[model samples]
Target: MPERIRVLHVEDNPDHALLIRRSLEREDDSLEITSAASAEEALGLLEENGFHVILSDYALGSGMSGLDFLRAVRDRGHDIPFVILTGQGNEEVASEALRMGANDYIIKRSGLLQFKRVALTIRNQRETFRARREKEEVEARYRHLVENVNAGIALARGDRFVYVNPKLCEILGYSAEELTSRPFLDFVAPASRETVAERYRKRQAGEELPSTYDVWALHKDGREICLELTASVIRDSEGISTLAVLREVTRERETERRAQRMEETLDLVFRQAGEAIFIHDLEGRIIEANPAASRLTGYTREELCSMRVQDLHVPEEREFSENKLASARLDGLFGFVGTGRCKDGTIKRCAVTTSLVRMGERTLVLSLVKEVPERMTSHEEEWVAAAVDARLKAALEKAPMVAVQAYDRQGRVTYWNRASEELYGFAREEAMGKTLYQLILEAAEAEGFLQELRRVWESCTPAPGREWLTRDREGNRRWVYSTIVPVVQGEECV
Candidate 1:
């Protein structure tokens, strides 16, 4: 804007050069451009003065091409913006020019808009290069820090080790030469191979995973050394790589094995756990049903396997079950205290918990069911209900600006208060036990809320409140804040 940009243009064609100069001049009067008929002339002119930008035709009349001119400029330590003007726009040729450090490119026939675009792109590229240089400096410092750290550090690509630090080589009882050429998975014990693979797959898929896991590495003496490995993935434009830090955990592994033995010895204590355990896919198709589940449902394992969760619930409860299943698709698990109709047509009070199990790219749900005792006193039942109601009410009360509601472990309307009724424009009777997720127009948002709740429940901790907007009866979206807390009844936490 002050003195105009100074641009040096090298073109063998007089007509094309004149057209480009006219276009640039028309675009901004602030442009002061000079033209050279050959790369030789451009080089001679550049020795006397600095130019803000350089535009060169890819195919010059002279033997030297634009790429050669670019290399020459770079060899001389010049960092001016360089744009390539080509008659033919081939992807391979364009890529080559770019790789050779061209700032931007445009086909001669592309019109004035492309030239303007190239100019803007050149300005942005300069800024980006500066930022990238700074990032590289920081990364170099970080690499230095990691190199000198005492912990064993090894870098790997997929299962193959690429680099191993001295400390890690010592811990593994192998020289760097022996470790770098081996498949990292070869050192992991067979028992832990699946876990390591799962973690690696997650990292490759761009998931940030915690790096602590148990593994066995082969020592120089060919002995299996149990170790605790902490690892992370380093990702760049190319692909994902692994960085693992190892610690000796032979003693911890021994302790774990002893604890496992003790647990096996005490397995008989839970042989009569009364609770029915059932595992199902996300679609609610029964996959595994324990003896207790078969007895409680009045269905044999063979019969249960063929039945969907919706088939077990009454027609009214079927909708509820489907809604919960859909919610579980988004949230990891869905739990409810509902009455499940047994094969003999009797309804049993049961608590059900369903969790999403991810195997590879597929997800399934595992459900556990426990039958509640019928001999409970009114005081006990009331206490349980009151506790659940109080928590649900408190969640709503705390969310003054937005409505809050909760579905019971059974997918029933367990708590619907004044704010929920007013905000949703639905009466308590209309909303209660109506399948909250399906009833809300913003099903996706409701799904998010449930997912957060499931995470908390699974981790046995308080979950963060999720803010969402739900459609009221009038189809107006009203904001909502929802949180779920598990209510423990007797020895079971629902």
Candidate 2:
């Protein structure tokens, strides 16, 4: 059901009041009428009851007239719509009532037409008041929201500050009165002023660009602040203006710059380092090769990056390289001596240190390959070495009882089989490239051992088996029967 309108009807004559009520109810039954013969009685009823509309006599019998009553209600901030009634149906009196803030006015007549007209005026008055009140409430809430929001909001005409919210004033450290009538670019840092102006000019010229970006701004105290500003062009009745929302991004932007600087530093180190570094993905495809790595392989950096780890391995070492890579993925770190094919189709020897590393979301391998002296003289020599290496690998892994070892011409242990590891109490990996006699003989026995080794090398003869005392890895003296034989490689004892 529709809500009934509450109306206060004020008139001096009882007959006129009855005529107005009966005529109004006959046409529309929605009006709930209350009687007041004088403005004084109407004021009392107004204090107690909330009426949506009010009808009053133009001239009251007591107290003030209807126009005076309307002024009083408005002065007291009452939200009731008051209409006036005149006995003579004169336009002059109706005009005077409306001029004094009466929502509407009606002229008394002998027929019921005046009653219907007054009912319509009351309905119109109620609707207009309700709409006006709601509009005011919405504006109040909007003003509060803009004032308290964190993002700074501002309006500009050309370069001048036209309007700014409280948040904008707070951000700039200025009062609204101080900021208004000032050039907006005055707050921009000197270094960023031209860039800001150019963007604004392009926007006004209808050119498309980024609507939001970072810029440097200045505070009232002359501190430089980074601002991320989003702006748009607004064409209003007055002219074209710019509306902007900005926030401080100093911390966030500086963090990004610091991260970029760190990346640059790391890249510089990688390019300038002495170690050969190759970075590849989990699938063995080379992603990056440092200058040292490229130089050692006799390939340009771009050429090396386009090749896979296996591509650089010598044909015979390809399987070994691939298997080592797969094993490194599981172990995270691995190393092995590999014969690689260089760019000029020559054999290059290197010991590669490979490790798995994580960069952001991708898994990669970072390898450091150090070049070792080439021992093979030709392809035929390499094939012979490869075959010997195969048998040597089996003996190192499967035969721990027979101590088989090899030494270079410099008297450094090049290969230590598994049997040597068990007999000497030092793993093969720990004994490679170490001076043989120093690792096994004590200081007191070192001189005699060197004399014996030199004699065996020069004589090309095998020394008789002799019981000798040697030190283990723990420096404990132990007894073993040892024979020395001169091993020759390429006309040299090795």
Candidate 3:
């Protein structure tokens, strides 16, 4: 079947005109044929018609013959395809029809299928001409794009160059013909040949491979150039091939290498540092302990890695350690004095500075610790205050006749001597954290004592060491002398 074609048929005999339509209709009913009995009548119809092809008889019985009609149509610029049919075979007459621009010439057959053959040939010629024009248009677009694209482009097969755009030739210092004459790897630097070869071979062998890779190519002048190559597989009528897009990355690669070296140097310095350094994960488990850390803790690297930060201090000193960590968590960095327990049960006082550090996906605490001699406390006044308080406590413990005690701003018992334990009938351990008024005073007296405690802490006034009626464990009323003082931190009691 072919495109629906409209035909103008000029035949004197109605039977011959019917025969022509039948021949084309033998394959499909796509031909619309209009008949005219004379050359003059066909000319009139042609002037008012749209037709794809024309068929005319050799002798129309009119003054004009089929060859005359064909020549007249071409001269008038109609240019429609014309075919002629004759009842007799004459070499001279067929030549005349062809010379007059008749697209075809056929001898009339009463019992033959020659008209179908003519119809098939005409359709084939029209299709071939159309296909040629479309191919030329596509090639024009491809040539324009490949010549003006910014990046270098190359087409290859079997890892051998098949074609290269002008930009690729410029990048490699070669002409398009020169680049396509050799293997693509011929321009690759010697050190990068194996990598480039392996990737291309795998791709050509139909194996899965990365779509992009970095390769170093040797320039014609012997200098190395880094190229980031993005590639794709092109499948067309020409068969399978690789298409590569190349970008220069020499400066970017140099910057990356320089930054990598700097990181390596910093890692080495951190490992060989003189102070005890540690990296602990967010869960408080030791992840990395430097050489100084092992020596400082009297533990091997393996031993330290199995412990949490809480495991390194005595229970009494853990609050101070926890406090330092809490401060570091809030501020991102902090410094504090704390005591650390060694593997042999010896204690080492250390000044600890901790900060948050992020490495890859994990967030960690990085600590730089230096040992502080036990006898070299930093603040003289603080040490003296502590010593004087300890002496007063010991003196009160030995004075059996009197019950002496100390309270924090909240009236919690911090210093409870032995005499307090005996008088209140509460063990030293039980009395340590309880409020003094809650332990031994009646409700009314306890309320009054709390009011006076608040006033003393507020005024920085001592409680005049007054005597009060307080109860003992036996529920018997007993008289005791008490005093209150505030432990101050900056402008507030702590």
Candidate 4:
């Protein structure tokens, strides 16, 4: 339902007021009329109520005329349309009334007949004012949104920029006028233009794509900035236009690239490590091994893959190997000195270290085996004799000096020199195969020295400057200093 139009009629004659009321009511049944007899009465009514249209007689009882009333209404900020009614119709008076802000003028004698037309004209004027106000309001909201948004926003047609917000200007270091007059592609760095064009074409085809991608954009000052761009098509009723948003992501992209390079370098190092490294599961089976492992163990990669960790240790040391693996799993690290049997039945002394490594959902044992050459030469005969001769010469030249000997685990004389003959009254050949304990009878009785020596031999640890009392071959007891060290011959323990 339409709202009723309210009419305020101000006339000095009662007949004229009644005629105006009847004409407006006949034209629009919903018209509500309010009457005032003089200009003063009209002003009072205006101050008290709201009206959509006002009609006033040009001669409003002398002092306060229709022109005066029109000025007063406008001065008070009332926007209602004011129509003038004149008893003495004259072109001069009508023109003056119009200049003084009258919306329309009609002769009193014929005014009632044109009431509908006058009412419609006034209604149209009001609607025009309302539409202007709404347009201004919408424009204000749009400006506010564009100025305050964080992302760089732009509207473009073909290659030219139609609109660019302050954020877009700030991002490119350009004024709004400067940006709008130029081609939109001018801001895109040359290297990235083709890729950006491809994405734009996809967007035009109505395909949805991820908004964020790495691209280079040129600023007004010619500096390049990495950007992440997102855009959507904006069309009117005819369907053709576009708006774009851009965000700077230079720092993020650089960081990601650096991290990727670091990961690649680390991967290369792990694959090409120089030392033998083996990874085994808790069950003692080799899960992964570096290339160095294959060369060090004298086994093909396939053969090593099939071999259990226990197979690397001497057969008698398998139980010890299992215990070490168990300890490493429980305590994280275990260190042991052991004999490793190579693929060719040759045993090598090694210091083995084991650690548990947790990778994702699985646990692995990492082993590092370092070859101990000095402890694996015990079975070489010629090298033992040569080492004994060298030591004897050094000891005999420095008489009464500490005697150092190398012995096998069974206590056989692996090294015998001139110093031992002078100190124990036995020739080098006589002491060659005899146990030092028999040459010096007190060797076994003095402070458990023989037992300690045996332990040192088995452990392959050097025992130096140990003072003990010993009986010579002739039954003479003497105090002497002795040291024992395992001898390595040709890189093997003897």
Worst 10 residues of 4 by lDDT: 387-396
Tens digit per residue, CA lDDT, model 1, 1-494: 44556789898889978987787777666676799888888999999976777888888875688888988988888878788877664667678888988878777567567668655654555556567778999999977877778788888886788888777877877788878787887777677788888888887788877768777767777778887788787888857888788878775566566456645643432234465766677788887677777888899989998988778776778888888788766655445655688988997766666665543355567666666665666676555444433432443464433455666544456667777777777887788776667577466765666666566556644454344567878788654444454543322345
What TM-score does structure 1 among the candidates reach?
0.36
The residue ranges of model 1 lying beyond 4 angstroms of the native Cα positions read 1-8, 11-38, 41-53, 58-67, 74-81, 87-104, 109-114, 124-135, 155-158, 162-180, 188-216, 221-228, 232-243, 247-494
- What's the lDDT for candidate 3? 0.74
| lDDT-superior candidate, 3 or 4 | 3
Model 3, range 215-241, lDDT digits (tens) per residue?
999877788989999888887888888
RMSD for each of the candidates: 20.6, 21.3, 25.5, 24.7
Which segments of candidate 3 are over 4 A away from where they belong? Answer: 1-22, 30-112, 119-152, 157-160, 165-186, 193-213, 218-223, 229-252, 300-303, 380-494
The candidate with the higher TM-score, 2 or 4, is: 2
TM-score of 3: 0.50
lDDT of 2 by residue, 1-494 (tens): 86688989988788878877877777778888888888778888999998999988888766788778788877888868888888784789789877877878777776667677888888888889889989999989987887788989888897788889988777778898878867988889999999999999999889998999988988888889899999999997998998889998876676566557646866776788776889998778999999998888899988988899999998888888888778766655545677888898988887676665666666688787767667745664555434433532453355424466666546678788776777789997789988756688766666666677778788754556455677788888765555565543334444
As for candidate 2, its clashing pairs are none
Leading candidate by lDDT? 2
Candidate 2 segments whose C-alpha is farther than 4 A from its true place: 1-6, 22-51, 63-68, 86-117, 194-209, 237-239, 268-275, 291-295, 298-311, 314-337, 343-345, 353-358, 375-494
Ranking by TM-score: 2, 3, 4, 1
Q: What would the per-residue lDDT of candidate 4 be over residues 29-88, giving only the tens digit for each residue?
A: 767889998888999999898887787877877768888888898888886778787766
